[model samples]
Target: MPEPLQIGVVVFPKVTQLDLTGPVQVFSSVPGARVHLIWKRIEPVPSDSVLVLTPTITFADCPQLDVICVPGGGGSDDMVNDEEMLDFLRRQAGAAKYITSVCTGSLVLGAAGLLQGYRATTHWSAMDHLAPFGAIPAKTRVCVDRNRVTGGGVTAGIDFALTLVSLLIDRQTAEAIQLRLEYNPAPPFNAGSPDTAPPEILAFMKERIAPFRQRRSEAIGRAAARLG
Candidate 1:
């Protein structure tokens, strides 16, 4: 029998659970795919959405991965500067087939100094931080730059994972899985992005995340310097 496809996702405190879970669900559905939630500690980690997930393996024990994903959320602010986690990710990516992230998770990948010179995307709010890491930030929902794959925002993990299915397995398999999951998306409102939202709403939304943006900018600056 062929070896199972090994996938590892970094699970940390205060992750935006959807960013991790969405892709994980997709990956788990694929035949011969083994997904591992990895962390330095094996304890349960909390998310902003009231979900607590346990890690499947510690950093030292994780096998060489086919994919290494980082999911971002409120906790990413702290993770952006976590030297231990950054070092772990850096070492893992050295052997992984693909290096990836979702939403603010890209910021964490950036901290690990992984996205440099890659075309990548993150949650719109955190996109600007990519430049400091030598990343060529794209404005799309999903991007594949060489072996570096990235998805934007929380929900984009699904599409990104499906994209991975095509790359790792085959288009036929990915399509079948998408159909099995009924992956059609039809948002009720046309207000998902700044260009689609009204002026006042965009202003308000930007204001709401100003603090996070400022903090990310500062943290990424420091992380980028480490790569220098």
Candidate 2:
């Protein structure tokens, strides 16, 4: 029998639950795949929302994984400057077939120096932070650069996972999984992105997230300096 495909998703305090859970849900459908929720410890971690996620394995005991994914949220601000977290990611990137992230998780990859010269994407609000880590930011929802795959924003994780599924297995399998999940998206409103949202709504969102953007920018600066 073939060995199980090991996939590890990093979990941390303040993670955007959807960012981690969406891809996990898709990955779980892959035949012979073992998905692990990883963290510094095997304990509960609170997300940006009310959700609480528990890590299945501690970072110290995590097995070599076929794929390693990082999901982003406000918590990423702390991780960008965290040597321990960055070190773990760097070690995993050495042998992992794919290094991927969802939402602001790409920022964590960038912090770890894993994304140097890779074309990647992150949450729209944090796109500008990519260049500091030597990543070429793409405007698309999912950006794939060789072995590096990054998804934009939270909801995009599902789309990103399906894309990765196609590469890992086959388009036929990915399509079947998509159908099984009934993954068609038809939002009641067209206010998903800044470009498509009404001017007022966009302005309001930009204003609302200004503090977070500023904090992330500072963290990016520190992470880049450390890389240098």
Candidate 3:
């Protein structure tokens, strides 16, 4: 028998809890998977939602993980300029079997220079930011480019995790897990995407996120310049 699979999910202030927890739940269900919630320290962290997550490991003590995942939210903006976090990711990604993210987490991976030349996806509003890191912005809910995998928006984490499990273990195992979780998705509204939303609704959504988008653009400019 071999060692259990080690999985690490990056936890941080204001991270969208669902983005982190959805995939964490799926991976934890794997037979030999051990998931670690990691941050700079072991402490309770708040999410954009009402949820509070606890980091179980510190970067200094974290073992090499089979998968290193960063989940996203407004906090992702803070992480773009976090040198320590970026350094840790760059180091871990150098040898991790899979480097991945959920939603805006890809922006953090991009900030760490891990997504360069890789095709990736993120929250629809922020997907354009990937270009600064030399990534091709994939227009799918889940995008996989070799060892790099990324998912779109918060709800997409479950789908991304299922796909990852299929690759890491087996399709049969993944299917069984999906069935066990009853992972069928049926949105009540057909407005999950810009293509499906009403024109006015889409415009309002864009307007709502404009300030964050502007800040992210500035942060990405700095992050990309540092990549040089």
- Candidate 3 per-residue C-alpha lDDT over 160-185 given as tens digits, one digit per residue, 9 for 90 to 100: 99999999999998999899899988
> What does candidate 2's lDDT look like per residue over 1-228, in tens digits?
988999999999999999999999999999999999999998889999989999999889999999999999999999999888999999999999999999999999999999999999999899899999999999999999999999999999999999999999999989999999999999999999988999999999999999988988888888899899
> Who is ahead in lDDT, 2 or 3?
2
lDDT of 3 at 226: 84
In the range 3-37, model 1's lDDT, one tens digit per residue, is 99999999988899999999999999999889999
Each candidate's TM vs. the true structure? 0.97, 0.99, 0.98
Against the correct fold, how does model 2 do in TM-score? 0.99
Q: At residue 24, give the lDDT of candidate 1.
A: 96
Off by over 4 Å in 1: none
Give per-candidate clash totals. Answer: 0, 0, 0
Error (Å) of candidate 3 at residue 165 is 0.2
* C-alpha positional error of residue 103 in candidate 3 after TM-score superposition, expressed in Å: 0.7
Q: Estimate the overall C-alpha local distance difference test score of candidate 2.
A: 0.95
